[model samples]
Target: MSAGEQHGGRVTIRQVAVHAGVSEAAVSYALNGRPGVSEQTRARVLAAARELGWAPNIAARSLGTARANAVGMVLVRPPRVMVVDSFFTQMLSGVEAELNRAEVALVLHLVDAFEQTIDVYRRWYAGRAVDGVILTDLRHDDPRPAALRDIGLPGALIGGGPDDFDLCGLSSVDADVAGTARGILGYLRALRHRDVARVAGPADLLHTAQRDAAYAAAADDLGDLRYRVVHTNYSAADGMRATRELLSTAGPPTALVFDNDVMAAAALRVAHEMGLAVPADFSVVAWDDSDLCQITVPEITAMVQTPALQAELTARALLRALAGGEPTHVVLPAGTLTARGSTRPPKRLG
Candidate 1:
């Protein structure tokens, strides 16, 4: 309802117009900073509105302002995994905080299947469920960008721009995923570990692809050094199994890098079960340094990736999209090395 026809709130724009002795359109124009009304009339209308204690209802504002007053994020990952994943958990908290400051709401949903994710995105746009959306966990040749464009929905990507993903016409807040890998490998190399391996997340993810490429390049840089990448989900169980297999191999790596803390902790536990001493028999490193990294016998060394910062910037990008801001890119720096008990100079056993 406009000021004239109001419900829910105590004061209506009709009351303000009556007090100002002006037509409702004139009052609305003055109050909204539109050009139709003179400065004196605008001031009078504003005063009248203030005196009436009238506030725009968000529900009514949404209808008139072409805004849903909420942003959407549809996660392909399940809630069970999301709770344990420090990256998502911390990132969401930052996103929520930023959105709160803007007085916009968040509509977050998790899908049990990948197919449902596309449907949710389409429905959210077709039904005006959100003003804009934040896309994450992007994959190779992802179709969501194209789908979003087709439906006239606005979105901001969590990864890089056109170079990193399809992107289409969206802006992005990119993380230094490859740089993080380089930092991890560089640290291990400095510790005199010639053989290092990575237990990474799913291969299809764009970030994982970037990290994998970096790992390969780093291996090439260290002449005669051995490196291998084992793909796994960001799960403790997968981490444990991968660690067991890597350790069982002959002339296994002297150091290991995991995509996340959960996997690193799993690696640490497996190393213990195999009667191998951490930082001696094997050194461990994780991409995101979280609380899980410190709980182990030898606190895991990790890279200080700021997932919260990434999420904050990503949220801002979505806000820009909602405001019809031009598409652009923002690249964030990679995580720095955080040396801990789980890393040391290479120690070899016969």
Candidate 2:
């Protein structure tokens, strides 16, 4: 029988090497596009492999090398929510850029809940599907770090405390959410907004809780600041509904702050429908600076967190963890405050 027929129509690297009259190593180098093979030898190997219909065994190759050469990112949110958020998009862009330079691949897995994220990680680890994993949006007493530690898995965390948890020798990047809150509050105080309303994200979220605590602490010293906090689901519709409720109160706030730009834009629309001019009758500030900030009639003043920068930093951290480095914590500096048309001195209360 011919070599192809003998191998059940499958082409082996040995057959390709024999056909090209080259070593198996040379065939491998040529097929993998490595530099060791000469141009003529590479051409011959390619021609032989093509003729024999040789296909590389990915699983066998991975097992032999013991390297997946890919990083996995587990995001604790729905895919739709992740897709709509500019922060995630820019962060992913940064991650892709860094990984591209290293010739590594990024695998993003979006899960709706913490349990689901954990389940996916377990499967990936058991299957050896990734070289490393990345964790984001950490909560109080998070179970992920501990679970990874027990399994001796390599990982990196974003927005969580390193000292509190056993991170399985993984690296971490922390954003100072409390400090971010203080800065935003300071900005509003500078704008002379004593009566302010904050539309916040889910309280269970670590960042949201930190911001809430910071706002409370900061508002304490500002005598008569009269701050009100409203919890929402980080949606535009929720923001609109919260703003409407706040506006209907006996003494509505002269300024509003939203945890996300999506809700902030919704607040703008709500103000318009209520016949209140932006930065005139009321002012607004958004936490994340994104395209949504500029879409409104009056652009939103916001904290500009470079998602791409965050993503790149996170990627590097993951790579370091994969290289057998001890877990390290990196707290990036706070983002810049961009002043736009959405904020100003409050209107006089008659």
Candidate 3:
């Protein structure tokens, strides 16, 4: 049998170096297309590697001049959210689709806090476990970008606009929040519903802040409009509680908008429990479309942001950054509000 066959078909760089009659470091430099090796040495290394059917082990290659050939993403959310929210699943599908095409692996982690998330990044960087990272749920004056920059790690931000992190050198992808908020509020106003309240996600989140500002501006632009916002953790329980409180108030909003479909579904349950007629009593709108919206009683009006497309764009931006391309921000079209049985003129007007 040949010497190569004796190694059980797993040829190491050391073996290639020995076969090429060169130092292991020289073989590594040559194989990885680094600057230290001459063309003759590189040719010899390539010939030796090919003859032995040798392939670079990703972990070992990462220790040398070669890239890790993988990217990381951390979700700082309760584990339950991971299972209940289809948004992450849809977004991951898009990211996976892009990474699969590029032959790169995705290292995903779930953590409960930002501090833990940061620790993960530090550990990943120290171990050379990833080429770069993807960031989500950007917060006001977020320290994550700075942390990544300090560690010299390349990154991309999902769910942020062109105006975010201008100096930190992160590529970002975002939908047109200002336009989406305007569209949703305008539809309600057109239906003669002047008192509208928003069930928003965490106040510190950049996108939620953006939505708040946009909604406020839109409400101001429409004279005689009364707008209010309540913050939540984007959970079904919070949605039901907030919905119950708002509907219980003596002069509550004539319409309500939720940050996600799960919350909107909760709002529907709240309406039923309170004996309030959807659309006839008050209207409901959800941020993202889902099966829950359609299956719920009095199907909810919702905004479709096309999460898969958004995620694909974000993944492409990260890939470009990893390839030493200039970082750029990409903005997708705004969410399209789909009117359903859940919205109409207020009872007084109807």
Candidate 4:
């Protein structure tokens, strides 16, 4: 037999299968570190391949060196909102800056439906269209993290919470969202605002949930604190609607904290039309400290969680995983409260 044939033709997958005492499919799964095969079987397959000096045939393997050298992201929002959202655009710029350094491309796909988002990931993985992926806007009981791991895909989840850790090949980076809410509430309370309101984003988001729970706890601590929360879809119109509802109430809030700068900006307009005086009749604080917070008549107080910096951190996490680093969870510093012109002590109403 020729040396190649004697050595099982330079170690085919079938030979590795026979040597590891596993099925060919298991060998394939094991070789790729897929979820189906047990760790023992995976190790055995790897050991057998190593002993036989069987290097991967990049031309034949799905996850070979001839990769796309790109990262994938699927955003679940309308195109107009994405275009207008300073946070998303700013975060994308940060993600791009980090990715550009390594000559890696960012392949962004926008999907409105949840099912479509999952399909995008599946397509990207099957086609080997990206070396890794970045996930954002994490929701409660999100399934994408696990789905990526099961398919042996590498990804970094941004804005995920504490419960998002420890998937097989998934990494995560998140700021302390709850702590941010606490700081906001604390600031409002210090202003002697007894009636405070929070205009929050979607209830299904994990980050929103964290903030919601923290808001509740802080309100509880401040005895005699009358608080209300209006959930919106992160739209300007929704912000206007929620703001109008609160202002029309018999006991309107003296201070308001909005989920994003867009909503906060919208609140300013609605407040003006309702004949409410800024920092006199009411106060406004936004979660994100975007440019929108500053350009208005009175600058908005904000919880300054730098979106660009956060996105850069998340991209670094994805790069680390792609370079063979073990998956890890990174916790970022909580956002800081920046006092501005839009908030003041509530006026005493007899």
Candidate maximizing TM-score? 3
Cα misplacement distance, residue 264 of candidate 4 (Å): 1.0
> Which residues of candidate 3, in runs, are more than 4 Å off?
1-5, 8-64, 79-82, 161-167
Candidate 2's C-alpha lDDT? 0.78
Can you rank all candidates by lDDT, best first?
A: 3, 4, 1, 2
Return model 2's CA RMSD, one decimal: 3.9
Off by over 4 Å in 1: 1-12, 16-63, 77-83, 161-164
Q: List the residue pairs that clash in candidate 3.
A: none
Clashing pairs in 2: none
- Candidate 2 off by > 4 Å: 1-63, 76-83, 161-168, 221-224
lDDT of 4: 0.81
Q: Highest lDDT, which number?
A: 3
Ranking by TM-score, best first?
3, 1, 2, 4
CA lDDT of every candidate? 0.80, 0.78, 0.85, 0.81
Q: Which is the winner by TM-score between candidate 2 and candidate 3? A: 3
Write down the TM-score of every candidate. Answer: 0.83, 0.83, 0.84, 0.79
Candidate number that wins on TM-score, 1 or 4: 1
Q: Pick out the ten consecutive residues of candidate 3 with the lowest summed lDDT.
A: 57-66
Compared with the true structure, what per-residue lDDT tens digits does model 1 show for residues 240-268?
98989888898889998898889998887
